[model samples]
Target: MLAKGKDATAKVLIVDDEPAFRLLAERFLQQQGYQVVSTASVEEAQQQLGQFDADLILLDLALPPHFDPQHTLNLVPQLASRPVIILTGHAERDLALKAISQGAWDFIAKPIDPDLLAVVVKRAVTKHQLEKELLQLRQATPVSSPLPSLAGHSAHMESIHTLVQRIAPTEVRVLVTGPSGTGKEVISKALHQLSNRADKAFVSVHCGAIPAELLESELFGYVKGAFTGADKDRQGLLKLADGGTLFLDEIGEMPLPMQVKLLRVLQEGSYYPVGGREMQHIDIRLVSATNANLPDLVRQGKFREDLYYRIKGVTMETVALDQRREDIPLLIRFFLEQLKEQQGQAFALETGAMQWFLQKQWPGNVRELKNTLESVAAIAQQGVIRLSDIQLLHLDSQGGGADTEVVDSALLGGLDEQVKALEIRLIQQALQQHGGNKSQAARTLGISRQGLLKKLERYGLSHSSADD
Candidate 1:
C-alpha cells in the first residue's frame, strides 16, 4: 500500500558491503516506487552506473577494498553526476559530514528510520529529477542559435527565442516581466533588431529611474522657452523613437499622472510638447519591461488598467537562473570564453570549482554569477580557477549579494540558526525598504515573487502588506 514517487522513473543506486543493509534499503526504495539498483561493491556500482543513469546513489562509508572513508567519498562524484547519500553508523557521523563536504548530497545514520530515510531520499530524488529534466530539455534541442545577448540553451530560453522569432516581425507591443537581472532589456533589444524598423532609432527610457516631474518632459520633450531652463528645441524619447521602437523599462513605476499621458500617446499616437501649440504624431512600436507585478499594481489602483492593457499587447516572462540550472555550465563556459577574448588569456575551472558553481543558488541570477567569476578570475593565478580561489573572495559569505549584511560573531546559536535569523532580518529590511511591496522587495532580494511569498508565509509575515 505504498504510494508511488512523483517521478516513477527515478533510479537509485545502492553501494554497500552489507547484504542485509542493501536488501533493506532496496526494498524500502522499491516500495517507494523508485527503480532500485544494488551493488555489493564500488566496482559493481560503477558497472551498473555505466548501464543505468541513476538519479541518486546510496553510498556506504565502509565500502571495500578502499574502506577509507575519505577515499570512498572521493570516488562518489566519479561514479556519476548525481546526488550521493552516505550510509553511516551513529559513531561515523563525523565521517558522514566529511562526505558532505567532499560532495555527497546528504547522509543517513545506521539503524535508519524508515520515515527519515524516505524523506531524505525523496527530497534528493525529486531534485535530481528536476535537474535531469532540465538537462534533457537542453539536449533535446537539435539546434541552438540564440540571439547575441541571449545566450542560453535551456528549453525556457528556446521557447523565448521561438516566441521572439514569431512575434518580432510584427509591430506588437511587448510587456516583459521577471526579476531585475534576468535580461528583459536584452529581449527588448532583440525584438527591435528583428523588426522591420531595425535601422530606425531605438529609444529607451527607464520610467523608474527618472523622477516623476522630469519623466514627463523626458519622454514628451519641451519646446524652446517652455521653461526657464529650456534654452532651445529638444527631442524627447517618443519623438526620437519615431518610425522605430520605444522601450519603456520599469513602466510599473510610472506616476499615475504620467500613466495617463502615456495612455494618451499609446491611444492617439499624438502629443504636444511642453508649451507647444502644435501636436506631434509619431509612428512607433512600444515595448515595455518591468520587475513589478503589473496586474497587482493595477488592482492596487497605482497603475491604470487601461494603460496596462494597451501596453501589454504581448507578454513574456524571464525565469530566475536557479529555476533553469542546466544552463549554468553553458553560461560559465560562455563567460570564460568572453574573459579569454577580452584579457587575451585562457581561463579554466577545476572540476571542484565547476561543481561548486553548479551548487550555488545564484540569487542574483546571471549578473551575480558573472560578477563572481570575474572577481575570482581577477585573482586566480595562471588562469586556473579553483574552489579555494572562490572561497578566498568570500563572495557568498554575506548571503548572496555584495550589499547584504555581514554576519556578526555576537549572534548566538548554531550556524543554521544564525543564518535563519539573518534571513528573517533581511526579509524584514526588504519589506520595510519597499513599503511592503512584495514584488519590488522580491526583485531587490533577487528572488521571484512566489519565492518571497513562500518565505513570508514560512516566517509568519504573510500579513505584511502596503502598496502591494
Candidate 2:
C-alpha cells in the first residue's frame, strides 16, 4: 500500500464501452495533463495493456457480451501492482456489496460530475504512486529504522520535543492539537519516529480533505467486487500501518459514522474493510491532530466521547507563532538560511524588514512566515531583502490592530468599514508588489482561490482585471 504525496502524476487507462464517455474522460484528463488511453472493449484494453503500462485502470462494469465476470477476473490478477477503479450506475445494496467483494479500488456511480470524476482519477493516480514508492522504499532499507526528525531548537519546540519523548514509547494513542500551519503533522511525525514502531509505516491521512463516501475505504481498504465499479482490491491506511502509526490529521472533521468505526478499531485492534467479511487485525499506534477543539466537539456531540478518550492517551498543544513572539527571530533566521542555501544567493535581511517581521501578527503561523520569506527571496534583485519587500508581502493585518490602531483610527469612520478599507489597501499593495497573479495573490493573502474570488466580488474588482 502507498502513502499519499503532493506530486504524483497518474497514467490512466479508461475502459468504457461508450465511445462518447471515453472521449469525454480522455479530454478532461488530458486537460489536467494526465496521460489517458481509452478503449471501447475489454479485448482492446487488454491489447493496449500488453503494450503499455498504466498506473490506474478505470473499468466500466457493463462491457457488453464477451467481457463477462470470468473474463474480467482473468485480467485482474495480471494487474498485480496497478489499481483498477470501477465505474458503475447500480444503486442496489446487493449489487454494491457484490462489486466490493470482487476487488475494486472504488466505484463511482453513473451521472458523474466531470469535476468529481477528475478528482477521483487524480486521487487514484496519487494512491498508486504512493504505494509504488513505499514498496520500493521498504525493499531498499531495513524497516526497523526511525523516520527523520523535525529540525528546530526554539524553546516552544523544545517543549513539544520533551512531550513527545514522554509519550512515544507507549502504545497509547496521542492527540496532537494545534492551529492550521502550526506544524501539527510534523509533531505527529515526531511522535511516530520516537515510538517503538518507528520502523513500520507512518501513514498520515488528511481526514477533512477526503470526501465522506470514500473516506472509509481510503482508511480501511475494500474488497474486490464489493461495489458496482470495484475491479481490484485496495489495502487501507490502517492495514498499511499495521505495526506502526496512523496519523489522522484534522480529526475533528471526520464524519460521525467514521468516528464510530475508528473507535471500534481502537478498542478491538480490528476492523472490517468496506466490503470484507473477516475482521482484519492490526497492531498500530494512533496519533490524531486537529485545529478544532475536540472537547468542544464532544460537548456538541459532533465527535464521539469514547473515541476522544481512546485517542487522548497523551495530549500536547503546539503554541501558535503569535503567542511565542520571542521565537520570531529564530524562525526568520532559519528560513533565511534555508533560502540562502537553496537559492545560492548571498542575501541579508534589512534591519527595518526584520523589525516589521517581528511586529507583525502571523495568523497562519510558521507556514505564512516561510512563504513570505520565500516570496521576498524570489523577488529580491539586490543582495539585500528590503523593508519595502516585507511590506509588499500581505501578512494578515486583521490581528495587527495593536500597532495599527493609531494610524487606522485617524483614517477610518467605523471598525467594519475601516477593516474593509484596510483589506482593500492591502490587496492593492499586494497586486502592485507582485504585478498580479490571482493564485499568487491568494497565497500572499493566506486564503484559498474561492476565498479570494469572494473578496474580489466584495471589492467590485473583476478577477480578470486583477492583474491590471
Candidate 3:
C-alpha cells in the first residue's frame, strides 16, 4: 500500500503507441487531476519535453516497430527529476525490478491494476517534489558547517553527516559496517580529520591485506635486532598515529593474537612493541570498519567479543547505493566533474544516458559507478556522453577491442544469472584493463589474488578470460 500524494500541478508524459491504451491511461491520469501528454514514440516524447514541463512519465516498455524494451528507458535524463513508471505486459518480478533498475520509478504489468497504478504514480510524484525541495533548500542554505567530502544529498546520507558531526569530535571508538566499495575509508578519513588531534598523523592499516605474521610488527614496529628483519628502531603505525587517529580497515580479518594485543592497548592506553620490554603509552582514537559480520564472528570465537564491544562504542551502518538511490545523480555529477578535471575536456551527458546511469544498479556500489563512468568518459565523442555510449560500455565484452561490440546477452536471464554474468564480465574487464596481470587486476577489483583466482576459476576464466 502507498500513500496518496498532494500532486496538484504535476504533469505526466505518456509514451505508448497504442491509441486505446493511451486514451485509457490519459483518462486514469486525468481522473486523478494530473495534466497528461501522450506521445506515440520516443522522438515525439523528446519534442514534447522541450515545450512541456512534466513531473512524471508513463512509458510502454513494449513499443511498436522493433520493440526494444530499453528504448524509452534510455531517455530518462530528459525528464530530469521526473519519475518514470514503466508499463509492461510481463508479470515477472525480475522484469519489474529490472525496469526500476533501468530508471523507472516503478513498473506495472499490462491490464493494469488501477489502485496499484494510482499509488505508484502518487508516490513517484511525491518523491519528485520532495527531492526538488531538498535540492532547493540545500542551494539556498548557508554552509556554516559544511559536511565532509562525501557527496550525496539523500536523507540517509544527511543522517550520516549529522551523526558524524556529533560523534567525530568525541574520543569514542567507532565501528563502521557496510558492503565493500561503499566508501568506508572515506568515512574513516572524515572521522580522523574532524577529531581533536587533526594536526597529527592519521595512519591507516588494512588488517586483511597485511600478513598475520607481519601485522604485529607493522602495527608496533620493533627495536634494532628485535627480529631477523629488524635492522633499526622502526616506528610502527601505532607510534606514528600517536596523538591522532588509527583506522583499522577489515578489522574482522585481524588474527586472534593481534586482537588480544589490540584489546590490551585499548584497555591500558598503552602497548609494547614487538620483542620490546619497554611499554609505550598511546594517545589516539581507533576507528574500525569491516564488511564481515562482527557479531557472528564473535559468536564463532573468530573475533573477540570483548574487543568488538570495545571498538564499537558507536556503530555506523551505511546503506547500499540501491537503498539510497536518489543520491545516484549527485554521485554521477561528482564523478563527471572529476573526469573533466583529469581529461581537461568538459563532458556533458545526454538525458537518456544519464537516466540509464541513475537507474543502473551498482553491485560494487560507488566504486563500480566511478569505474563505469570513467570507462565511458574515456571514449565519449567530443565531450558528449550519449545513451549509445553507455550501452556500449555495458555491451563491451572482455575488452573494448572491436568496432562491432559484444554483450553477454545474459542480462535477459534471471536476476541471479544476470549477476553471475556481470561478475564474470567485470573480472574479464579488470584483467584486460591491467594487461592480463592477475595481481594488478586483483588490486584494481579490490580483491586479493587468491579471491580473484577463485572467481576466475568459478567463471571458467582460466581458459582465456584474459590475455594469459
How many clashes in each structure?
0, 23, 2
Q: Give residue 33's error in model 3 in angstroms.
A: 28
* Candidate maximizing lDDT: 1
lDDT (10s digit) by residue, model 2, range 257-368: 9999998898898999888997899998888999999999999999998888888888888878877776665566666667777878776664334545666668889898
| Cα lDDT tens digits for candidate 3, 1-468 | 111224448878888889998888888788797888898887788788788777788887667665777655555433434667777775443454455444455556677767657766777777677766765654454332234257787787887788888888899999999999898888888887887878888899999999999999999988999989788888888999999999999999999999999999999989888889999998889999999999999999999999999999889988788888877767776677777788788876654455456646667898888888888888788787755566566642322222222111112111345566787888889888988887678657654343465456546767454433
Which stretches of candidate 3 lie above 4 Å from their native place? Answer: 1-145, 340-345, 395-468
Q: Tell me each candidate's TM-score.
A: 0.56, 0.51, 0.56
- lDDT per model, in order? 0.77, 0.68, 0.73
Q: Output the lDDT of residue 422, model 3.
A: 82
Q: lDDT of candidate 1?
A: 0.77
User: Global lDDT for candidate 2?
Assistant: 0.68
| TM-score of model number 1 | 0.56
User: Could you tell me how far off, in angstroms, the CA of residue 96 lies in candidate 3 after the best superposition?
Assistant: 27
Residue 252 accuracy (lDDT) in model 2: 95
